[model samples]
Target: MKAVLFANTDWYLYNFRRSLAMSLLRAGYDVLLISPDGPYGPRLRELGLRWEPLPMERRSLNVLRESALLLHLVRMLRREQPDVVHGFTIKCAVYGSLAAKMAGIPARINAVAGMGYVFTSDQLKARLLRPVVRGLLKLALGGEQGRLILQNSDDVKLFRQAALVEPAHIRLIRGSGVDCGKFAGNSPRKNREGATRILLASRMLWDKGIGEYIAALRLLRNRGYTVQAMLAGTPDPGNPAAIPEQTLREWVDEGTVTWLGHVDDMNALLASVDIVVLPSYREGLPRTLVEAAACALPLITTDVPGCREVVADGVDGLLVPVRSVEPLAQAMRQLLDDPALARRLGEAARTKARNYFDERIVIERTLGVYAELCGPGQEARQRRYG
Candidate 1:
């Protein structure tokens, strides 16, 4: 059997879906990855998997470019002719599924990582785009041969209410689960012991609560708390919410936070910090929180959909209101001042991660989905729907 994984960015395959590919290969299925060419493309090649480059634009709203992209994907799907095609992210899922259908592919799967900003508003664009996307999704997932996978219940409920997908076709999975064993608890990094270090690992986007995090940091500093802040991850230039490099540099210079831009060793970084913070306005399920929990670090995050799934309020971490600085500051201060409380929370978090978000579980479940789609069941599905 053969499977093709389609994504908008090469980084998505590299960072998150590599395990799934490896699992497929181990299960004796040929795996092919299709994404825009990048530095990570060669790495995928080195993994003995087939790699195809597509000209995908991540944040463009250009109709002509997107149509061209759809044409390219359709051609690729016809040529490669994989048994099953799985699409990730928003645009990829929309376009890839449509192309796979056009090519008469037997199995199609769409993984909705997050609802994203497009579905978060009541603007004319949102109103217009939602129906268009929903129409495309309905066409792609309407048949018995396709499945729609979501990361959180909130997204599942929202899309169901919107009538974007049939309830029977939708399946739920945890945010690409983390490797608890790999990110297991470790002693804090040897450092200036007197200070508290808080780390926020996410893209530099306004909706990610970068502004709120900075404001909370300033508030904590003003209150004379011995604190240090770190921000990691790259900025998406095409994304409207991206923070300017100059502003980020200014924050670093002002000593408000340490900017460790795009560190590969996230587990080590999480180990070094006293607290893991993600004040994101929303999430599909932030992998950073799962990694931190695997490392047995306590969390401070917003009371948003994806964030809430990871942190159990006061049990393993604290939840503050989305986009609010005061609540964030208060939560951070409470953890910083109360060492015993932080330690207890961290232990609780590690325990929870082991029980729920093990990476092996995610890989197994994902492979099961692939198997169901490509196995003998496909014949029955086609007979029923075709």
Candidate 2:
């Protein structure tokens, strides 16, 4: 079987879904990865995976360019004629499905990671585009050959409520999946003398609650709590909500946060930090929190959709109100003050990661989807799902 994995950026494919690609190869599928050109394309090729670049502008609204891109996809699909086309994220999912349909592909898998900028942003532009995007989604996600993969139940609910796709066609897959073996072996903090290090690992975006995190850090400082605020990952230039590099530099200079730009080795970084925090407004089951959980690090994240999916309140980790500074600060303070509580939470988190968020489980589930949809002469099964 041949599978084509498509995404908006090469970096996303390299970092987030590399394990899934490798699993496909192991299963004797000819895997081809497609994304816009970037440094990571060569890295993927180095992994013995076939990677091709397709032109896509993340922030483009030009209809002519978008139409041309769709045409290009249609031509490529007709040429490659893969058994299954699996697309990650919103734009890729829609375009890949549309093109796959046009090219008469056997199966399509559209992974909607989150309710992205078009649905989440309160900006006028986003608001204006929402209905149009919804219409496109309805068109793209229809029919028996295509299946929609949602990361969290909340997204599943939202999609159902909006009547975007058939309930039977939607599948809940927790995340891209974390590598437990690789991210494991973080010991709980004990007898630490210096400032408590709180790390937030994500792209620097306003919607990610970077402002609230900074505000919470300031609140901690004002309360005379000595702590080190660290940020991993750089601003995403493609995202409209991305915080600028200059602003990040300014925060670093003023001692508000120590910004570690675009960290490749997250395991080492997670091991160094005492606590992991992601006050994101929303997510598609954040890889950072799951990776931290795999490393047995206590977490603090928002109570919103995807964030809540990983951390049960006061169970695996703490959950604070979204976009709130005081509650976030309070949660951080609590974790920092009580070592025993933190240790208990971290231990539980690791257990949860092994049970639910392991990459092996995800790969099995995903491959099952492909087999169900693309298996030779499964007419009865297709009818049941359809």
Please give me the total number of clashing residue pairs in predicted model 1.
0
Cα lDDT tens digits for candidate 1, 1-386: 88899987788898898888888898888889999888888888898877888887777789899889988988988988788889997777888888988888858888888877566544576677777777777677666777888888898898788777788878888888777888765744434466788999998887899999999999988988868789998788756567899999999999899999999988778878889999987789899988898887889999888888889898999999988999999999888778778888888888888887787887877777877777766778766665
Highest-TM-score candidate? 2
Q: Top model by lDDT, which number?
A: 2
The TM-score measured for candidate 1 stands at: 0.95
For residues 211-295, what per-residue lDDT tens digits would candidate 2 score against the true structure? 9999999999999998888998887888889999999898999999999888888878888888999999899999999999998
lDDT (0-100) at residue 120 of candidate 2? 85
* After superposition, candidate 1 runs with Cα above 4 Å error: 121-128, 188-192
